[model samples]
Target chain A: MPTIIEKIFQMHTEDKVEAGNTIWLNIDLRTARDFAGAKVVKNLLKHYSSEYIEDATKTFFTFDCNAPANTIEYANNQQICREFARKNGIKVYDVGRGIGSHVVIEEGLAYPGITAVGTDSHFNILGSVGAFGQGMGDIDIAFVFKTGKTWFEVPETVKVNFIGTPSAPWSAKDLALLCVKELRRKVLGRAIEFYGEIVDELSLAGRITLASMVTEMGGIIGFIPPNREVINFYSKRSGKEIKPVYADDATYEKEIDIDVSNLEPLIALPPSPSNVKRVRDVHDIKVDSVFIGSCTNGRVEDMQAVAKILKGKKIAENITLKVVPATREVWREMMNGEIMKELFNAGAIISHSACAGCASGQIGMTGEGEVQVSTSNRNFKGKQGAGDTYLASPETAAASALTGYITGVDEI
Target chain B: MKVKGRVWKIEKDGKLMDDIDTDMIYHNKYLHITEQEEMAKYAFSNLEGWQDFPEKARKGDIIFAGENFGCGSSRQHAVDCFIALGINAIVAKSFGAIYKRNAINSGLAVLECNALDMAEVETGDEIEIDFETGEIKKNGICILKAKPMNKIQYAIYLAGNLFRYAEGI
Candidate 1:
């Protein structure tokens, strides 16, 4: 009677509650980014001393949210966070695997089935690995830090069933973007669980993108149950024991499916993550800025994929392309592979290690009249700059940078 | 402990009552607000009116709100700032997950109905909220029904969230 999500939650909870219906969880782990965590830590420590906090050990942290160009903010936040972690004996991983807190928790030896919560909306990305995670407020997160457990009102789960295989160059990001557009701003507060055949083929990265995009749907994170792929990822990467978790066939409260093979590369136009269209539809839309970063597209392949497109091509003279690798390790790998150089030759301004050029105009500042085609997720108003942003795959980002217009991955 | 007061001010539109810019909160170009709790009490950290926030806000202090009261980044500092500053239950048209959850979990009240009058309730106006049942009163009269928290969230609120709800606080 154990549903897939229940099993994952139970990995940490073990038997805190039954798995048949819905359940609230005792969180084993929690995290916050630079933007929120910095502020929360400031307030949490303001009047009440840290000595009063009883469960600091269960709390963890990473440097994201306003990480600087060259990501200097990484070190800045690290110093404050490292002190907090060392003082509390919390495992601080800001040294090398520093990136989005949620991404690292799953990829960086954080176990599966343990409950995780973070301040970032897409913290639900942990769902790709069967972790019961969600975006919460700082007060709640502070409460989580003060206690190892977090209380939740169980939400009605929306089972997103994936039917056919995804065609070439089409990925889970495509489906998530499409879902965001289809669902619009109305589906907020819903948790999406991707189930079915394509779920089997989904890579951890794909599932993460799918779940991460739930923030765009005005919903919390999306999730996929732990399958062999997740198991293999943990065994090989985390050096931790990861057990398989499955959902009962009929336990899903609802179902939604996407024929993966039928999907083409897609893009989300300016103003929102839901303003999506087929990449082919916007290929000719002119662009002046192309950004590829943020936790959404900061992974290795998203960067490398864009690099492959910019290979041997010069960037458009007037276009400004900003390529920021999501993590230090990703940056190191790209440097070793000369992906960074190829991007630079193509006129892309490579930024320091952080979620650069993605938002707040710190690193990749676009102008008033410019049009940006970003690979990073979300195309909200003035997301990257005070200009237009068109979201697309990295391949499309590169093509847009080269030709000064959005283009499908294959067409380029 | 319950000093019934009327709403001082509320912003109904999604726009900020004050202009928000990086120069006020962030000390550096990096995307982080300074650790100064006083500075980050509100999302628009360095606005003119922030300093005008009253300390030890009384009960019945009409808490006006805007649409999607907790939109933008998921920072809880905004909530703590308002809580620390002593604003009572909010009367916003909408609230984000984090804000709504936190307000409920922390035992603060928010009424989402009648957004316009909710916005109309100004500071110094008398207001009252019954936590056990979602009830709202404005100017010595019951004006609306506050959106009730579901049983689970309400439980967390009653227990003061996970930390207090734990075996021992």
Candidate 2:
């Protein structure tokens, strides 16, 4: 019996997909964003021509990163992408279209049992939908474009069982942080198959958030095996019947169990996502800005969570609160509902749904010596301009916005 | 493939740098810059004590790093920036998965060596590496032997890159 990943690979490769065996499989989907897709498209057209593109429709391009073109060079790069997409008939998501990863799922490009590759490392987010999302280099992506297939070294699979459900204020982000801490920064190049009650109970947004952070753990994929919840979720959106895959009882190489019953809201301190700490212990740390968006937590559920905390109340006067929805779909949903109104009325600067101001500071930059609590995946030094960033869930980020400090939702 | 060069030990405030993510090598602020040749100018621009690296680094120089080097972001520029700097190879205790893959695919030599004793080798120490056999010599002394790349990786490296390697296939 093989793990879910192995099983998927076997089906794609039509051979026994053993760990460390390199085999090529036809790619179901190829994704790229403006940040890296510019180079990928250039390389593809320059070295390999239209003939190299196996199927233009299978290739999806997006201009989410650095959207709105912060610089002239980026604008030029976006033009290059547009020209390439036009020539190849590839689907291109322009500025404010939303993140490529989210769009892939929303458009039903990714679904259960499919193998997809992307230029961004966080493509693993698609794994939450039971698709095999692997991040490949630009050359690899170009090759995949040129030839509708790519090779892979079957990775060892690790079983990650989330034993219990998370209570309020403790969303999937907190649960992911806990798993990251417990994994001890040694999960590099492994497929972490998340299962058990906690994963099955998490919403699609929560599952996507959980899978997005697997990059921080150095894992190739954070797979939540398909259950009825995710199957129905994808089927409802894609309007296609789907079959989910699960691992056998003894398929995984190693097992790690996480009990979320007592898990509290957590935050990854600046410079590294693995530097996690309990939210209550870091109350002394004040924040100058609060960002409630990113590929990780910029979803409808995350927006709803933040709005629930900020509704009927204003944020702290000293700090700025910025909300960027992950996609236009998410943004429209929030706007059509009360989330957008609650956020804006509560003093939040709700920016357009783009990758604005998360790491590049295209929209919201932290001032010198300032601190921030963000829901973004990365908190590396100066990631969001020249400030110390603390990574938290949307709930914590909203609660912190209320007090202008790194406070938990319960504290508010 | 083999490389001979001087080791540029990246340190700041008297502590060896660890987990130097791709952002530190090349920031997203410069992601818009498409030309790889021009990227070397901003190499280590965000990293402390290394902003002036482009001016100091020489062709065929090796970067010595601690665990999880080149972590974060699947930016090819992170690997390409070093190539622009004419970095011969990178010897670290470990490397981020994406960086390692990009490095190999781009024909940039990267080897995992456990004997990255910062105390044993000072900054600017001359080192020699045999990538095929995973041998490392510091100041003409064989200090460590890293695990050699598997057959597929070696073939890819020898062919100068993945594209060239795939051409023959």
The TM-score of predicted model 2 comes to 0.96
Q: Is the docking of candidate 2 incorrect, acceptable, medium or high quality?
A: medium
In model 2, what lDDT does residue A260 have? 84
lDDT of each residue in A171-258, candidate 2, tens digit only = 8899888887887455777888887887877888889898999988878888887767778777888898898887776477788888
Best by DockQ: 2
Which residues of candidate 2, in runs, are more than 4 Å off? A14-16, A49-52, A165-169, A359-362, B12-16, B139-141
Question: Model 2: DockQ against the native?
Answer: 0.67
Positional deviation of residue A299's Cα in model 2 after best superposition, in angstroms: 1.1
Error of 1 at A270 (Å): 2.7
Best by TM-score: 2
Kindly report which residue pairs in candidate 2 clash with one another: none
Which candidate gets the maximum lDDT versus the true structure? 2
On residues B1-169, what C-alpha lDDT tens digit does candidate 2 reach at each position? Answer: 6788988888766556778988898887888766789988888988987889999999989988877888888889998899899999888888887888898888888888766764376778888888878988766787788877767778888898887888888
DockQ of each: 0.29, 0.67
The Cα local distance difference test for each model comes to: 0.61, 0.83
